[model samples]
Target chain A: MSIVGEIIISALLLVGAGFMLVGSLGLARLADPLQRLHGPTKATTVGIGAILMASMLYQFVGHDKISFHEFLIALFLFITAPISAHLLAKAYLHMNRTDRE
Target chain B: MISIALAVSAAAISFSVVLNLWRLLVGPTPTDRLLALDTMVINSIALIILFGMSYATFIYFEAALLFAMVAFVATISFCKYLLRGNVIE
Candidate 1:
């Protein structure tokens, strides 16, 4: 890769790292449990995704090897995260319903 | 090329984390927090994969896979606990 490209890649990685840090910080700092949850789900997700993509790109361009595992992981995450979240929410709602009765 | 892709994806993941964080901070119920935690774990798995690529090693990928499996089980247990007030019940 060209020096310019390397510089750009590094810059992007730094930005992604910053995002992850910020997200984690928010998660730790948020007051309520509900509020704390948002930080990792949104900001941290993007941060981690960017970093993973960068890794894949690096391997593809620099090493000239086919890479698909990360994609698979991404797919798995996209599918499962929502489902788990839904289940948890449902359970919480169920608990609340029982409590109110 | 791979580096660029990794960088972009990382940035995208970061955006996702921020959005989830917003939801967590403003959530009105405990369920919302739990949901966010689930999301975070998924994101972390992705991050581990990226780190593996960055380091040019397969260990990170293995770790990620393990995390994914464990996370699923953990979520199930937590959800069960939430519903029945006991993990085994």
Candidate 2:
């Protein structure tokens, strides 16, 4: 790959890593569970997508191989995250309901 | 070109993470925490993919995939437990 390409890839990686770090920090420091969900669902999803795109670009440019594994992971994550969040939130609501009864 | 792209993407992702952190800090309930955790796992998967590209290796992809599977299962179980008071129930 050309030097410019390499530089771009590195930049993407760094940015992606920064996002991941921020997301984790948010996860750890959030004050309440309901509010905490906002951080990971939105920011983290975008952050992860950026990183994955960078990786795919790097592999495509350098190795000449269209690595689809990353895509598979991304797909799995995209499909499952919302479901998990929904389930958890539902559970929480159910518990609250029971407690109030 | 590739490096520059990667770097830029990484930086953007980092900014998002920071924003998420702000939400986590102010969340008002336990469900919010779990939601943050779910987002964290997704971000981790992306980070793993970036690592795979940086190192020019495929092993990281496998690990990332595995982590996703485990995270999904764990989340489901936890949610079930919370709702019914037992995974079996």
Candidate 3:
């Protein structure tokens, strides 16, 4: 891979890893279940998305081949994450509904 | 440079997975556990991608894609069960 490609891949990997770390930290340390919901849904999804982007670039720049398979993973995750998060949140709220009564 | 980055990022992501495990084991609520499991799935996906990049292979791409699909369905079904007291009903 060229120097520029290497640098870009490195930056993306580091950034993605950092985001994953922070998301996990939030998941572990947040006080409320609802509060903790933010971490994995947003930050972690973005983190993996970034990593997949890096993978796509790696295939292109390093191997000199076009690869779009990573995009399918990213797209599936992006579409499903919010739906699952929403369902989880709804379930949590319903489970706790008696408290508000 | 790419190898160094891959190593560091892999280490960091692995640590994050450990954190997710801790939350999964110790979470006070089922929702918290679910959240942790979901995060762990995402982290694992990232790890697989990193491994593929490290090895310079294309085969792992399908593995990652299939894992993502399976994980998503699993999460959704779990959520549905939680919401409705049953997955199918």
Candidate 4:
């Protein structure tokens, strides 16, 4: 890979990894489950998205092949993450309501 | 340069996975545990992609995609079960 491509990939990887770490840290330390939900649903998803973007760029420049498979995975993840988070939140609220009543 | 970045990122992700495990173990409620499990699935996907990059192979792409699909279904179904007391109606 060229120097420019390498630089971009390095940055993406580092940033993604940093976000992932922060998200997990929040998940482990947060006192409220609702607060914890924001960490993984938002931060972790963005972290993985950045990593996937780096992978796609790596394939294009390093391997000299254009791969859409990474894009497919990213698209699927972006589409499903919100739906899953919503469902999980709703389930949490329902359980809380039932427990209190 | 790229190799060093990859190694560092891999280490960070591994640590995050450990943190997710910690949450899973001590989470106060079932919802908390489920959230941790879901986050762990995402981290697993990140690890798989990093493995593919390290190996310079496309085979793992398919595995990652399948994992994402399965993880989504698992999360959704688990949520449904929690909400309704049954996975499927």
Most lDDT-accurate candidate: 4
Candidate 2 lDDT over residue span A1-101, tens digit each = 87776777666666656656665666666665555555566556656666676677777888898988878877877787678767876877797788799
lDDT of 1 by residue, A55-88 (tens): 5666666677767766666566656655665676
Query: Once model 4 is optimally superposed onto the true structure by TM-score, how far is the C-alpha of residue B88 displaced, in angstroms?
Result: 1.3
Q: What's the true lDDT of residue B50 in model 3?
A: 92
Tens-digit lDDT track of model 4 for B1-89? 98899899999999999999988999788888888888898898999998889889779888899999998999899999999999979
The residue-level lDDT of candidate 1 at B68 comes to 74
DockQ (CA atoms), all models: 0.27, 0.45, 0.90, 0.90
Q: Give the TM-score of candidate 4.
A: 0.97
lDDT of 3 at B21: 98
* TM-score of each prediction: 0.66, 0.73, 0.96, 0.97
Superior by lDDT: candidate 1 or candidate 3:
3
Local lDDT at B75 for model 1: 82
True contacts kept of each: 0.33, 0.75, 0.94, 0.93
**Which 10 residues in a row give candidate 4 chain A its minimum summed lDDT?**
A29-38
lDDT by candidate, in order shown:
0.65, 0.67, 0.89, 0.90
What lDDT score goes with residue A24 in model 3? 97
Candidate 2 off by > 4 Å: A28-31, B1-40
Candidate 2 C-alpha lDDT tens digits along B1-89: 45455455545555555555555565555566456556656765665665565566877788898998998998888788777779975
Q: Which regions of candidate 1 are displaced past 4 Å?
A: A93-101, B1-54, B85-89
Name the regions of candidate 3 deviating beyond 4 angstroms: A98-101
Task: Spell out the clash pairs found in candidate 4.
Answer: none
